[model samples]
Target: MTIIFITTFSEVHADLAIIAHPDYQGGELTREMVKELFLEEKLEFPSGHKAIPANHASGSPDRKAFFEYVLEMSETRHKRYWARKVSVGKKGAPKELASHKEVLDWIKNTPLGITYIEKTKVDDSVKVLLTVAVFDDL
Candidate 1:
């Protein structure tokens, strides 16, 4: 008799390109600041304009990486945290978009919009504020 085994594996790594409106003169953000922006703790840009954050949908792979590497939280926990914040009128979650293209469109049209997307999706339209590797720790 003979025995055999087959194994398969796949890997996906994402890099975050933090982008903002062209007119944003708010300067660079530290990692902590980026975290705050995503968590809705920072409502206004450094220039004093209200910030409208565009985020990937809960199920997006990039979103998953952002939560794990940047926000350091799981999807469910993030949702629960935002729910509680919204209930008390403390904050609101970012506007969730289904794809990077949608997020790019929102950022282009919104004067104060900020979002982190895959590095490859960034173009000349939006200003790059920062870049963070989603798997830097790995």
Candidate 2:
């Protein structure tokens, strides 16, 4: 009998760039701060403006990478976490959009919106807080 290995691994890794609206004056956030923002632990910027965290759609690879590397959770766990938060009356997960363009558009218009997107999709309209590499493994 012949045996063939069928592995399912991809070499396409992506870096997620954290971006905020151009009017954002809260300045850069540390990795921990970013984590707190995504985790819904922080709801406002240092400037006291409401921090609205946007996100690429649930199944987007960029979203997956951001959650894994930045937020440090799997998709299911992340959803559960947000669900629990929502049940308590806190804002749920970030607004999930379709594509990078959509995310960029939303961020550009939302003064307090923060999001992680592919570096290449970033433009001058948004302020880049930081760039984080999304590794395939924890």
Candidate 3:
């Protein structure tokens, strides 16, 4: 698992970008929760840079589209919206965020804080559900 930190609940959220899916844990992500969790305290969560689960993969035509749905918008409709922007050169294609290792280094020195929890699983085939609660920041 990975950790993402925010200083205050009211601030805007960073994109919950998926860097990779080496273990294939897929689900929905939202900025509002990330934003509110920042409420007047430091917050952290077990973040995974991966998809929700194969069982829920969107009907979208491509990997990028599927990811944006499951990981970013909580649905696939936005994939086409984001895709159009990419095609027009108004936006660059979204890269998978980065491996946990690269993200760890970035978080270490950055004012915005984060942590990495251990990777785990419950079933042999089902990866552990990514879960975490925040620590109040000093």
Give me the candidate number with maximum lDDT.
Answer: 2
lDDT of 3 by residue, 65-131 (tens): 3233233343444456556766876543222323334433333333223212222211232222323
Query: In model 3, where do residues sit more than 4 Å from their true spots?
Result: 1-30, 33-79, 93-95, 109-138
Residues 59-111 of candidate 2: C-alpha lDDT, one tens digit per residue = 99888888787888899998889889889898667788898889989999898
Q: After the best TM-score superposition of candidate 2, give how far the Cα of residue 69 lies from its true spot, in angstroms.
A: 0.8
Off by over 4 Å in 2: 1-12
In candidate 1, which residue pairs clash? none
In candidate 2, where is summed lDDT lowest over 10 consecutive residues? Answer: 6-15
For all predictions, the C-alpha RMSD in Å is 4.0, 4.0, 17.3
- Give the whole-model CA lDDT for all candidates, comma-separated: 0.81, 0.84, 0.32
Q: Which stretches of candidate 1 lie over 4 Å from their true place?
A: 1-12, 136-138
* Candidate 1 to truth, TM: 0.83
Q: TM-score, each model?
A: 0.83, 0.84, 0.26
